[model samples]
Target chain A: MKLETRRVTKRYGDFLALDGASFQTGKDARVVALLGPSGGGKSTLLRVLGGLLLPESGEVVVNDQPLPQEPNEALKTLRKNGFVFQGYNLFPHLSALQNIVLPLCVVHGFSEPEAKERALELLKRLGLEEHFHKRPAELSGGQQQRAAIARALAPKPDLLLLDEPTSALDPVMTGEVLDVIRELAEGGQQIVLATHEISFARKVADWVVFLAKGRVEESCAAEQFFEQPNSALAREYLDGLSRYR
Target chain B: MNHPPTRRLLWSFALMAAVSLGLYITFAAVHYSWNWSSVWGYRSQFIWGWFTTLGISLGAMVVSIMVGFALMIGRRSTCMPLHLLSTGIVEVLRGSPLLVQLLLGYYIVATALHVGDPLVVGTVLLGCFEGAYLAEIFRGAVESIGASQREAARAVGFDTAQTYRYVIIPQAVRRALPGTTGQMVSLIKDSSLLSVIGIEELVQKVRIMNSSSYTALEGYLPLAVAYLVVTIPLSWYARKLERRFAYET
Candidate 1:
C-alpha cells in the first residue's frame, strides 16, 4: 500500500502534460481523491499510475518496487491494479460477464468454470446479475458503468484507479454507482478516484490531492482540505464548486 | 398454335432468330469457311486448356493471398527493420508491371538460379506481383481500426502481439475482403500474361491451335469463350465473399 511518485513528468511531443507532479499515499490513507477539472493532469496522473503511459522522466514506486517502462513488465504490475476510465473502455466484442472474467482467465489463467463462477459472483454483487450475458451495447449507461467496476474488481487488485467514474451519470444513476464504490471502500479496498463531486469527496475520501496546471495545489486530510484549504486556488475552487452545486 | 398476341410474339422471336442465323451464315460463308469437323475434334483440347489456365490462376491467387497477409502483418510490426524491408518489397513489386514480373521470373530467376520449372516459376511470379498490391489493401484496413480497441486490449494485459492477433487481424481481414477479392480477379486476369513465358494456358493454346489450323478467328473465339467460362464463376465467388465478410461492418 506504499505508493509514491517522485517528480513524475510527461510530455507529448512539445506539450508538457505533467510537470514535476508528485504525491505519496501510505496504507493508512486508503482513499486518495485527485480533485481537478478536466485537462489539469488528473487523467495523466492516473495513466502514469496504471503504467499505461511511460512518463518522460519520473519514478513511480508501488510497494517499494520500481515500475518498469516495458509494456510486458508494466502489464504484469498493472494486472494488480484496476483502472476505471471515464468512457468505461470495456471490450465491445465481449459480453458483460466475459469482459469481467477476461482478466482472471487471461492474466491469472483461471479455468473456465472458476472464471465464470467468479464473474457471476462479482456481477451479482454489483446488482448486474440479469445483464451478465448482454454486451456493453445492450446495457444502459449506469449498467455499463457497473460492469466496468465489476471488471475492475474481478482480479481483486491492490489499487483501484477511477477517472471521473460518476461524471457521465445522471444524479439518480450516479448515486446508485457511488454506492457500489462506497461499499468497496468499506470493504477495505484501496481506492483512488479523480472526481468532480465535492460532496462525494467529503463523504468517502480519506485524503484529497488538489491539482492545478500540472502541479499539486494542495494535499491534506479530507475534512481539513474541504474546510480550510492551504492554497487560495483550492479555496476559490471549493467556493465555485459549492456555488455551481 | 396460340392466341393472336402470344403467337405474334413467338413468330417475331423465331423470325429474329432466323435472320440472325442467316446473317451469321452469310458472313461466315463469305469470309470464314465452315469448319464443323475441326470444332468437333478439338473440343477435348479446349476443355483441357481452359482447366489448365483455371488451375494455374487458382494456385497463383492462393499463394499471393498468403503472401499478402504476411506482408500486411510484417509491415505493421513494431520492428523497424522488418517494416522497412516489407515496405521496400511492396514498392518494388507494385512499381513494376505484372508482365515484367512474369518475364523476370521466367528468365532471370528461373534461368539464373536454374529453377527450370516454368510453371512453378510463373505462378510464383504472379503471386509476388499481386501480393504487393493486396498488402497495401490489408495494411490500410488494419490501421483503420480505431485506436481505442488497441488501448482496451492493452489495459486487459494483452501484449502487443496478442492485441494484433486477437483484435486487429480479425477485424482487418474482414474489412479488406472486398479489396482482396478485387485483387484476386485482377490476379486471375494477370495470370493470362504467363502465356508469354511459354506456359500453355488457354490463350497460349489458342495461339498454338491458330498456328496449326490456320483459322485465327475460329480458334481464338472459342478461347475467348473459355476465358469467360473461367472468369464468370470467379466473379460470382467474389460477390459471395463480399456478402460473407459484411457481418460486423
Candidate 2:
C-alpha cells in the first residue's frame, strides 16, 4: 500500500501545527519513524495520517483513493488502520480483556465468543495473559501500553500509527513496550511511529522523517539520514540527543 | 475502673438524655390538649397517600432520566441548532420555579392538551423539572472524560453511538452516580409539590388532617417522620452504591 500527503496544513486557532507538509511512502518502507523535538508536527502529522485530526487544507490519498471529505466516509477509510496513543488511553472502566473485545464486538461486529477468542489470543500474544482481567488503573505502565498495542492489533488493520508509544514510560518500561513494537515490525506490519528515542528509531525504522517547526526538515532512509542529515536542524537535533544520552 | 474516653462517652450520652427529658417536660407544661386519636383515625389515608407519593416519585424519576439522557446528547451534539435548542430548554426548565411549572402544567398545559388526569400531568411536570438538573449532571460527567478516550474509541472504528454506548457513557454513568443519587432524593422530596395540584400525596393528606383536626403538630410530625423514612434509607443506599462502584480508578 502507498500513502501520500500533498501540501497538508493543519492549524489550531492561530498556531499552525502542520504547515504545508508533504511526503509519500510506498510499501517498501514498512516502518516509518517521525523523529523530531516536541511540538515539531510529528504528532500532528501522525494524527492527520490516522484521521484523528482533519487538515485545514491538503490531500491525503491511500491506495490512490483520496480520504473522503464527509465525516462518516472519512471514519470508514480511517478504520482500515489502527492507532496507539502515547497515553495508552485504555477504557479505565473495562478490564484489559474487555478493552480489546469491546471494539471487536461493537465496531467490527464480532460475536461474543468470537470477540472473546480474538481478544484472548492478542492479549496472550502480547504477554498480558495474567493481567487480562485487570483494569487499566490496576496494571503497570508497561502492561497498559502492551495492552494498548494488543487492542490496536486485534482488528489486524492495514496500517498502524503510534504516537510516542514509549515516551511516557521509564527506560526499562520503554524497552518493554519497544520490544513489542519491534516484534510487530519484524512481522512486517506497516507502521508509522512518532518518537524521540533516536536509537529505537534507528534500530527499527526503515525510513526517517525529521520534522522541525511543523515542517519536514528531511526524509531519507534511516541509515543515510543518521549518517549525514540533509538539514542543519536535523544535525543539531541529533547532536543534542546524543549529548543527552 | 473506666477509661477516660469511655467515661467521656457516658457523660455525653447522659447529657443527651437530660436534654431530651427537658424538652419533653417543656412540652408537657404547655397544657395543650393532645388529640392523638384524630391523626390515628386516618391511618389508611396516610398509608394510601404514602404509596401515591412513592408511585409519583418513581414515575417521574424514570421519565426524567430518559428525558435527561436525550437532553444531554442534544446539548453535546455537533449540530449547532440542536445544542442551542437543548440548552435553551434546560435553562428554561431549571430557571423557573417548580411551583410555577406545576401550576402551568395543571392549568394551561394539561387543559390545552385535554388531559384531565392529575397524576399524569404531575408526573410530566415534575419529570421535566428534574430532567433539567439531571441533564447538567450528565453533561458534566461526560465532559470530564478526557479527549483521548474518544480518540481511542474512534481509532478502534466505533461510530459516535457505539462510542457513547460502549465507552463514553459507561464511564460517565459511574462518575455521575453520586450526583444522580442526590437528584433522585431531591426528586422524592419535590414530589410533595405535586400536592398543590390536588394529587393527594402524603403532604396533601397531612394538610387535610391538619385542617380537620386543628392539630397541626400531630398532623405534620408524622409527615416529617414518613419523609425521613424514605429519604434516610435512600441516602444510605446512594452511599452504598458509591462505595460499590469505587473500583480502582
Instruction: Identify the candidate with maximal TM-score.
Output: 2
Per-residue CA lDDT of model 2 for A91-115, tens digit only, reads 8989999999988888788998999
Per-residue lDDT, model 1, residue A8, is 84
Residue A105 deviation, candidate 1, in Å?
A: 2.9
Instruction: Report the C-alpha displacement of residue A3, candidate 2, in angstroms.
Output: 3.2
RMSD to native, candidate 2: 3.6
**TM-scores, one per candidate:** 0.84, 0.93
lDDT of 2 by residue, B137-225 (tens): 99999999888889888888888888888888888888999899889999999999998888999999988988887888888778988
Q: What is the Å distance of residue B123 in model 2 from its true position?
A: 1.0
DockQ values of all predictions = 0.30, 0.71
Superposed by TM-score, candidate 1 places the C-alpha of residue A61 at a distance from the truth, in angstroms, of 2.1
